[model samples]
Target chain A: MKIALDTIRHSLEGAIPGVVATCDANGIPNVSYVSQVHYVDSNQVALSFQFFNKTRGNMLANPQLTAYLIDPETAARYRLALLYLRTETDGPLFQNMKAKLAGIASHTGMAGVFELRGADVCRVLDIERVPGAEAPRALPPYNWLTVLRALGQRVAGCGDMAGLFEEVLGGLEEMLDIRHSLLLMWDECGHKLYTVASRGYVHSGIGSEIPLGCGVIGVAAQYQTPIRITHMAAEYSYSKAVRENAGLDPQRLETAIPFPGLAEPHSQMALPLLASGKLLGVLYVESAQDMRFGFEDEDGLSVLAQQIALNLVQLQQAGDVETDTAAVAVGASPAGARLQIRFYPANHSVFIGDDYLIKGVAGAILWRLLHYYVHENRTEFSNRELRLDKHLNLPDIDDNLEARLILLQRRLAEKSSALAIVKTGRGRFRLQVNQPVQLLEHEVGAAL
Target chain B: MIGSSAGIPTPMSTTAPSPPVLRPEDADFIRSGVSVCVASRDVRHVPSLARGLGCAVCDGGRTLRLLLVKSQSEALLRDLEKSGQIAVVFTRPSTHRSLQIKGSDARLETASSGDEQLVQTSFEAFADDLLTIGFSRAFTGLYYQHEKSDLVAVTFTPDDVFLQTPGPNAGARLEPLP
Candidate 1:
């Protein structure tokens, strides 16, 4: 049945972050968030989706479908029916979608600034009134990483609290588009900031020590409040010791921010890591772009950090799983305690020492990150490439990848002595392990 | 050269050992020479041709013709036939170097019907390594009038094709693809 234009408009207005789904000939489905939907005619509407999505693939394969728009808060639903028609440059439908999109892009302040490409045209046939489907099941409130930690609790238990901390650190990096993310745990006895887990800048001798409230990272430790700085002048006002610390070079940190070659602008955010109302550590994310973090980012990161705190507390309560498992497996001798390594031609993982071996797509992603530890390479690769490498070609990784890494990092900490490795960052495929071990080992029997 | 001597008229002093004359555009596609004699074109569905041989019908001498593909897809041929799209299929078998295939009504998927065997066989025979397939809009300057026009040229390289016959005729030259 034909739905009226006014009704469609009302339905769309309530559906913030509308979702569009498309399928390829191979039956692969893709879904992404779209901004606003514009009605071209009574029988047609157009919407702009996040660039480089699977919906385009589906539209090319089978053009008939409907879009689901939902209310994020109340979880209400709206459906817009559409018929994606394959058209050339001169097709009337193609021109219509483009014209409608131009207005929306301009209203969003994008206009011609961002590289906005148009996909094949599809006529929006009708708006349907479908009852709201369940909001993509509210991701279990228990942080996935925390859940994995609990599952592994009985099997391996949380061994490396330090490693668990780093896994959580990585999750924070991903949620927020911050380069050079670091988690500095507060030492109650020493009253100092120590780099427990870090990504981005290299750790020289000086970064290892900072008195509480002496620097930007340290002040967050002291105050237990989240802080953000748009410029270094603001950072200097926070802590005089931070202004002089060898690690606090605003110019160099600017160069090291993710997305190399864009070093003109700068932004920074620092958040406290507290579990049970006790300061566990501080997370710092820096960007070379101004106004980089928006309300969505702030909210997402706050939730992510809170989840990390829960995981850290659970790890502490479980006691060190890695040490207990390792003492039985390896003798007190240093050689016996040395972390054992194994490599697989394709994908490989094993339960060694305290950490579980995560190979294949998990292995590739983890390996790429740890490799970054040796020499900080923050080249942003596409999600497709990262997923293909990790063999997890599902649309999203920011959630699943972190869950897996959290398990891996905690397990590795249990198995090995080095507690400072395995940090995560904003980019896809990142791993930071304290031990600089070569992933590929030479077999003595095969070589001369 | 299984059935070449019977159906096709051979030129004087032509032998299977002699190299076949190739159209200029198709020469690069036949560096190693023809390997099999599948059908040039097929009008009716005929299965089990000589147990392993392939067959198709071509209107003899069709040079390249420009067409447009409305939808870019894995089933490219099917998408081409979906209307408002353009492409060229062969009409009959002929031995002319400069062939013309202007406005010829042709059928696609005559042999395989639904299977992609002909496309597979054609790719294997034409280029052993299966380099590239000819699609619409290759010779755009000559064919397309407006930038928005959906037109592409389909160039067929017949050098890798053998006429099913007793022997090859040296004077049998292929028409140039676009």
Candidate 2:
């Protein structure tokens, strides 16, 4: 163990193919080139087990193996002595390796053949640098530690849900120079992920819906793991995935809201925001350049995503407290023609005249607010009361309520309707109705 | 059997050398620009791997000559001494198309006068191919940079050839093109 295995992760990224050596008990050796050597932790690294080949057989019979890792940056080589720990068929490790293998395979013209079945976990038994004159160590583009700390600080300064998301995604652009990204909150009841915040797209797509398990974002959410692809593969493309999904059922309005994504992003990473094993959302980032988000970037963003998830739980729950109901003035509406506020109770869909505004739980919340406004003459409300209400049917504390409110708010702004939900304070907000609204509930067997 | 421990030994084999199974097309591919790696194991089956400078297939496509630097391949050379068994892989970086040839009896000879030109040609081809896939000239230099005086020739008659192009067909026998 002359050197730590953690620092040489660049070599293990499989940017340059790595050589893996294994042997059966007969003293006969088998050598193969592996596409990726996944950095599982400080003591272990995993290789994608794409097929049940001689290497897999040799490993199971005699776990002793050697891996020759060459740094893509420095061309420095190292020999890792690893003991086969176990093969993970499913979990964070397998899913992560599967997604990466898919990207590399497609990039290398091995698209359909490079399918991952499991992750071969190996414990680092020894590590020694192979003494050779290598290319000089090049400086990385920017210090990720500095970027991470600054982003964390920016998120720390945020007091509300909207600002928190903005600071996180905005920090990626301003600090890390990552241009395109989306922050999507998982809708548990609907089994879909809705865009709550986005950056670097022609269309904001604030209310875009992607069902769980369609594309990279959906897969990341489905497995509660990060999915990163270095090259664009049509099978994993969001446009194709959503199109295939809609082809199954074209009548569904879920596909109506176009997903804001690049046509052919070379590199993309979707990191799940996990809080105590519960997935809050997915923070997706992409670039037009190949291998743009390397292993280190994924490591940095995964930590940031977890922190964001925890902060979201705390911030959203903290917003549950009722306060500032009377501090903000509820201004009178301007004289204008009353517009029809159409509601479909079946899916909780709301329509402003003819254009679809929103649906699902967010739609239900908006309708409730409008209902109370029309009947009880109430203008201000708190998130605490919404969470306690049984009618809203909010999922658990994991990525709930506040995110939906943010979605509702963004949708209203996206549509530029007469209605607006303005945050008055930490918890209280006023529903500013610029035009008088007529409530029309459209349900089967109900008076129109 | 973990990497730290050894498993039951399958008694030492005294198998005879078999004829080359490398197809003519694969022979040409191996001789062309490709990332070459040579590997062997100690008596304990603990394998050692080393990068190859370049490669050449000769003797009517039966013999495989791989050039490795003596100074950088001490462990691999030591392992090959005890177990003549060897496995060499050649991969084209741009397409990721690859093949592996295994030899039960491998021999190391001093790099020849004519072998220098053969190795140099492959180096340029491999470097140029890697450049097309975004590898800088300096980075590609790491594989080709070696003193001609230190180059050792590892020669073996291929016993079997396997398609190692990283797909469902990987590790399968390299069938001849129809």
Candidate 3:
């Protein structure tokens, strides 16, 4: 069977450097090693225009070129006859190529030298297998379609936002074989993304934030497009982004929260979870091995992201269930250490003693949960009750209530405080306080 | 024949000034475990390329001889026969230091007695270089494999040498050799 150009798109990531050949008008041919042959579409690809060399000169004169690409998986080779189209210095394509080039440059020890001047788009005129080359070996045993089908079913069965979050992360690990992954929520006003859930890390990194356009995850959220990097670049590394942003405003940066990521990741893929043109957040995954996540993984995650966005919107719109008005008798406060909960109204930052817990929606959710537990003596809570609570000012139907609950639970656990929230049943939880709690509200401008 | 050829622009008219000879240091860099590729174009200006097995620089760094697998050189050889012009690139994978040498007069010949050993040594060195960078030996060996009977040599006199390294001076012509 003849393979289409798009079928082998993953092989174009430049793991095995591609050879691009172009001829001058006089017929003298120039061949140069290309770091990447970016797949633009079925019939088009883009090459990085880093230098004004013989290959570039030949393309300008002849407009005809050929590129030899190798399939890293199967070691099969293909020849593409390409016609130079145009050069783009800016926009999504340029940014995508620029980010990818940074990774390649760093991987090859040419960090400062390999800058992308432009993205030279070309029309793939034809694609043919190199005659007499070995046939492509069998692909890996995993079938994406089967995995996607099972994941869709699991996602559909999720009863609430928390369940959905768990299912999504679980499916990525079990169904897709991805171990290290994170789910972050977009903070529109803050201009950052905060981690709500994570897997395969020592710390869950809940509430850790990455500023928009900071790294691979940030770039994906900024453009609302999927960004994949085969080789990790220091320019886009999370640690570097943290250090660079730390000098800025403390309020604007989440410096107190450490971002959880691999110390040295060779491959990373970030996809924006967008619904109806609104950027919800980003789904990120990384691996220590190079080229671990290919186009197939990207496509699979893309489909999952779309479904996740839709479900989130639907659940948010469903709103909270009607509140139960009957007041319940509160049990006497347990005898233990006194826990003081201080709430800063300015940024909605909540602190238990001297340690900062969370801010924003998650913070608001904690404040609300504790408020009910103290005043109403409400030991039990459900998803619907919180959704209907007006004081929380939960964002539209897109509000990730379950994710916030998980964040609250993890944060409380990490602090090992006397106050804890444990799951008793679906969409319901029990607030366990082993000590007497004093709640205090303070103005933002007031001294600590 | 240099500038009077129809349809082909004079190579020296570009911003880059042609070098007089290949520098000794540059020749040594090329002969090292550098990645090599050769290219030529057909009458319609469509280009063809092939991996170069190894290369030898002689005659005081004036003559360059490139070895290629014959089975993979069909299109490249055809282009050479038509135009007698070729451009070859030698890039050190580790450092990304690269050079492009173009020749107006190129000829293809059978591999000589010592050419096989030279190609073998070059391949072994290249494989070792790749190993240090995390590529498995078996993989590198398969990539560099070529039947001795299927090897052919293309010799050319370097006429234009351009710095192809990734940097601000990339594509700039080197100083003219005395």
Worst 10 residues of 3 chain B by lDDT: B6-15
Where does model 3 exceed 4 Å of error? Answer: A1-3, A25-28, A132-141, A246-249, A319-338, A369-398, A420-434, B1-3, B6-20, B58-62, B110-118, B141-150
lDDT, candidate 1, at A31: 33
Arranged by DockQ, best first: 3, 2, 1
Deviation of model 1 at A81, angstroms:
43
Order by lDDT, highest first: 2, 3, 1
- Compared with the true structure, the alpha-carbon lDDT of candidate 2 equals 0.82
In CAPRI terms, where does candidate 1 land?
incorrect
Stretches > 4 Å off in candidate 2: A243-253, A324-333, A390-399, A445-448, B1-24, B167-169, B172-178
Give the candidate number with the greatest TM-score: 2
lDDT of 1: 0.38
Expressed as tens digits, the lDDT of each residue in A239-258 for candidate 2 is 77776774333323365578
Candidate 2 Cα deviation (angstroms), residue B120: 1.5
> Which candidate, 2 or 3, has the higher DockQ?
3
- Candidate 2 has a TM-score of 0.90
User: In candidate 3 chain A, where is summed lDDT lowest over 10 consecutive residues?
Assistant: A318-327
DockQ of 2: 0.46
lDDT tens digits, residue span A39-101, model 1: 445565655432543345556556754465543333344555567654334333333333333
- How would the docking of model 3 be graded? acceptable
